[model samples]
Target: MNINDIPNKSFKTVYKGIDEMEVREYLKEIKQHIEELEKEKESLQKIIDEKNENLNNFKSVETSISEAIMVAQKAGEETKRSAEKESERIINQARLHSETMINDAMMKSQHIAMQTEEIKKQSKVFRARYKKLIEAQLDLLSTNDWEELLEYDKDINVEAQSKVDNIVNNDDNVNN
Candidate 1:
């Protein structure tokens, strides 16, 4: 339904007999839903932040582990070498997973941004088209032909009577 179909605030008092409490309750429900969505958005933001922090931590750990491995190899300790290699491998895998999570988060953010932009563009196009249509309608209504048509009705009736009189006169002459 169009916006106009909804009554203005001043006219809404006509339904005073109806329990406005229900309307209030429904509005409260909508507000609650909006709040819930906002909370969900906040939670998603926290998840993204945590993922980014974890990714950074994993990268640091990977660097430190690589350096430790180099030191162990230089010292030529087989046991230390095996432990360092295992730690490096684990750190590398964690870093890879964290990077994937960060990439996914970035992709989701970009997708949302693109969708929002597209919606804004569509709204702008709709507004332009609506304005053009309204202006065209106004132009049509403002034309001289519409005014002339309004003025022509009276003149048309007079002209019709005159034609009838002439037809009658011609019939009388033919009868004579």
Candidate 2:
């Protein structure tokens, strides 16, 4: 017979020899076994509840870890954006400085060119004046009329004195 059929054969044997005292004793033993099984079931239920509580705690920790990761990612993104903005600001500042330097250099070059042109004009005027003075002195030296030359020299000296006086007076007026 199969192992499953053994319990049925034992049950039949027990029932056929069943005296009242023996039956009472068997019933008492079965009742005690049933009570013990009920207690074991209660203990198993308690163990299951504890395991469920531990699982819930693990789920809470997992959720917290996930939230922390999300926060860290957001902060990293913000930091990257801030760094990019700072880099852009630095580039813009450099561009602005470059433009300013170029403009200043251009202005300085224009000023220098203007000054050079003015100096050239002044030099030309001084050279023409010097040539005229030299020609006048040479003509006076080659002249045969000494009295006329002396008179001319006196007139030139008077004109020179007048120009000096005018320059002095203008300087005084400007200072005042």
Candidate 3:
């Protein structure tokens, strides 16, 4: 069934059957091996969940940035339109001031365009950096460190619990 059931497993023995102690030791090893595998599975799942959360956060930020850029663009367009209308009205009254006002409005529009470009550039860089970070984490997850627990020496008697403890300690140290 599970790890607990492995060690507690009972096999009927006749006078010429297998040794009970040897079978139990094997079952114990199997149980410990399953436990180690489960721990590794849980650890990997947590890492994956964390990475997924980070990805979700990144998407949210990207959406917010996009929305902000749209708002900025809309505002810029509206300002440009309003300035053109005001310039038209001023030109009907005084042609001299209308030219200066139109030039100022054009400069404002250009400045907004420059700022939008900078924001887009920053968003691209952030996305690239986040992608690299996720790739590095995936690479770390695929490393040989996970298999070290399965490579235990069979000659040792009480090494299973100690190895599990060491792995837990190492994980704790890393988390801290």
The candidate maximizing TM-score is 2
The candidates, ranked best first by lDDT, are 3, 2, 1
Task: List pairs with backbone clashes in candidate 1.
Answer: none
Rank the candidate models, highest TM-score first.
2, 3, 1
Per-residue lDDT over 1-176 for candidate 2, one digit per residue giving the tens place of the 0 to 100 score: 44333223333455567665666666667666777887898999999999999999999999999999999999999999999999999999999999999999999999999999999999999999999999999898887887788899999999999999999999999999
Model 1 spans with C-alpha error above 4 angstroms: 1-87, 149-176
Window of ten residues with lowest summed lDDT in model 3: 149-158
Give me the displacement of residue 170 in model 3, in angstroms.
99
lDDT of 2 at 61: 95
Total residue pair clashes for candidate 1: 0
Candidate 1 residue lDDT tens string, 5-29? 3232222546556556666666567
**Model 2 regions more than 4 Å off:** 1-48, 145-176
**True-structure RMSD for candidate 3:** 66.0
